[model samples]
Structure formats: C-alpha cells, structure tokens
Target: MVAGRNVLRALRDIRSFRVVVLHPADAESDELVAQIRRIGCRVELIWPPRDGIPDSTDIAFLLFRQDALTDAILRSLEDRPLAVTLIAIVEAESPTVIEAVVRSGASAVITKPIRAFGLLTSMVLAHKFSTGKLISAEKMSRLQTRLSGARVLEQAKAIVMSQRGVTEPEAYALIRERAMANRSSIEAICASIVSTGDVPGR
Candidate 1:
C-alpha cells in the first residue's frame, strides 16, 4: 500500500509547490528571497508573519529551528485555512518539541542541512497532497480504511456511552465490550465493525 501510494504521488504535477520561507532577515531578507526566486518555483518571503500568509503559499517552512512555535506565527498561518507548515530541524531535536509540532498540525519535517533534491521532493509531494491528488489504488484503499475506522470508532464510542454509561472517549471500553461479546481481540473487533458493519447487541 505504501509503495502504491508513493507511485501514485510520484506521478503528480511537481510545478504546483508554493513555498513560504519564514522568519526573514533584515537587509539580507530580500537578497535571500532573490536567490530563492532564482530556484524557479513559487516562493514567498515574509517576516513577523502578521500581515497574514500570502494566498498562494500553501507549504510554509521555518528555515531555522524554533524551540516552540509562537502564537503569532500560528495565528498568521491559521488564517490561510489550508496552509501546511513544514519544519526544518536537525536530527537531535527533543521528542517533546517534535510532538508539539505534530500536535499543532505540521504537515512534514525536513532535517537540515537539506539537500536541494530532497527539499524539492518534499515540496512537490506536499503540494500534490494539498491539491487533492489521491492517485493510486493503494492510496484509495488506505483512505477508505481510514474513513471507515473513524466512523466505526465514533459509533462504537457512542454505543458504549449510551449503554454502559461512559464518556465518549472510552475507546478502551468500547473495544472491550465489542471484543468480549464477540470473542475477538479489540483490534479484530474494531476492524470487523469498521469493514463489515458488524456491531454486537445492536
């Protein structure tokens, strides 16, 4: 599935990537921006991030390592509605910071010092996904699986909350109830419910 997803993604249009390089330089900002422009795909140069994200810059990169993202930066990008943040970091960053970034909805991380090819590839792949390219049988299958799982989890949790008097998040209780009743593992029970629409005592 992963291979087929990559194959479909690889066939997408690479030209659609629009990158925003943030945390700008003073006198050097325009110079670096000019150099980035010469690299020849759409690139936006911004600082302070307060004026709001330019509409075309779908993928944003923090060219330097920030221990934690500032609320201002988050606010600026959030205004874009569909913007995806790309963070660049070295390999030794603390897992906590990485977790924060992921939890905050970052799309991907690029480890620096970056190769031009790898950067370009990441940009193209992100843009393709952002542009709604679900190009392979495997990707389609995986997407269906994800949607099915989400639906099943929601319904199962609702069932548990209704019948057993538990909170909506008792994923464990929902699984346990379905599993014990059906004589199956929680994983298998959830999979059955998701894929085959089976629910015990419904």
Candidate 2:
C-alpha cells in the first residue's frame, strides 16, 4: 500500500500500537485518554520520564509546557534511535519552540484541548511519516556509499593508468580481472591498489 494513504480508511483500519504519553504529570484530559483507549492502543502515561521512552513503545505523544523541559526531552530522544513516532502537544507556540520541535524530529503536533479524532489522525500521520523518513534515510546512505566507492575506484584507475601507461578501458579491465580472481568487488580491488600500491593477485 502507498504510504500516507492508510489514514483514509475507516477507524477499523487503525492498528493497535503501543502509545506512550510523555507529560509533566500523569493527569491527562479524560476525553483524550478515553478516546485513545477506544481505539485499542495500549497507552502509558509517564511524568518526568528519567530514562526516555521504553523500547516497546511505537508512538509517543510529548506534552511540553516549558522550553527547559522540551530541551531535556529532545536530548533524551537523541541519545539513541528509538524509531518511535513523536507527536508534540503544546499549549502555546513560538518560533523557537517550533524550531526545537522540528530539530527534535517531531512528525506531528497537536494543540491543547486535544480533540479525540484529531489525536488519532496525528498518530496515524506521524507513523506514516516516520516510516517513510526511515526508508528514505536508508536509501540515501546506500547511495552515498556507492558514490564514495565510485570516487575511490576512479582514483585507483588513474593510479593504474599513470603507472602502467594503460588506457582507461584497459585499467578498468585489469581491475575487473583481479577482482574476479580474488572473488571480490572491483571497488575492493581498486581500493587495494590505491592503498597498498599493488593490485590483487599480482
């Protein structure tokens, strides 16, 4: 299924995930609490969490009333990769606060007097965005690795051409032959040449 479209489904489509509420206190609005329970999400409300959200948590609703607490929460979240969807609940907004929320990797935000349905929607959206972001980051990392390898290979090919007076194609062919003989990647063979000033199987 295409991401971000699952929310269009009926309420029955909502998956039961572990939901965590990080607040200054345990006393959450009864309406919001009741609504979350109705959707069958296992909810835990923790006030002044010392150790950040638990590993079992899949979604987090973070309530912020002061900048200091917000900074502290963000630091805790950054200490490790939790893969939890963050939803910020704020009573007031400021430029600094909004910037902090973005930097902290909040996927969605809800204001005070939280509506039952609005919270549900935010939860779903946060999960979708979080999943998509992770996938994109992974793809970017792979692309970066490939690009770095290519740059190294080019440099190694240049080294071969300069030393052996070979054409570009010949240099590449030489690298490929060594890689095949060694049962390794051309990049690995090239890296060996660049690093050790010698080709594999030479």
Give the worst 10-residue stretch by lDDT in candidate 2: 3-12
- Per-residue CA lDDT of model 2 for 87-106, tens digit only, reads 88877787777777778788
- Cα error, residue 125 of model 2, in Å, equals 1.5
Off by over 4 Å in 1: 1-12, 26-39, 63-69, 83-92, 131-202
lDDT (C-alpha) at residue 90 in model 1: 37
In order, candidate lDDTs are 0.58, 0.79
Q: Judged by lDDT, which candidate is best?
A: 2
What's model 1's lDDT at 123? Answer: 59
Q: How accurate is candidate 1 locally (lDDT)?
A: 0.58
Error of 1 at 159 (Å): 26
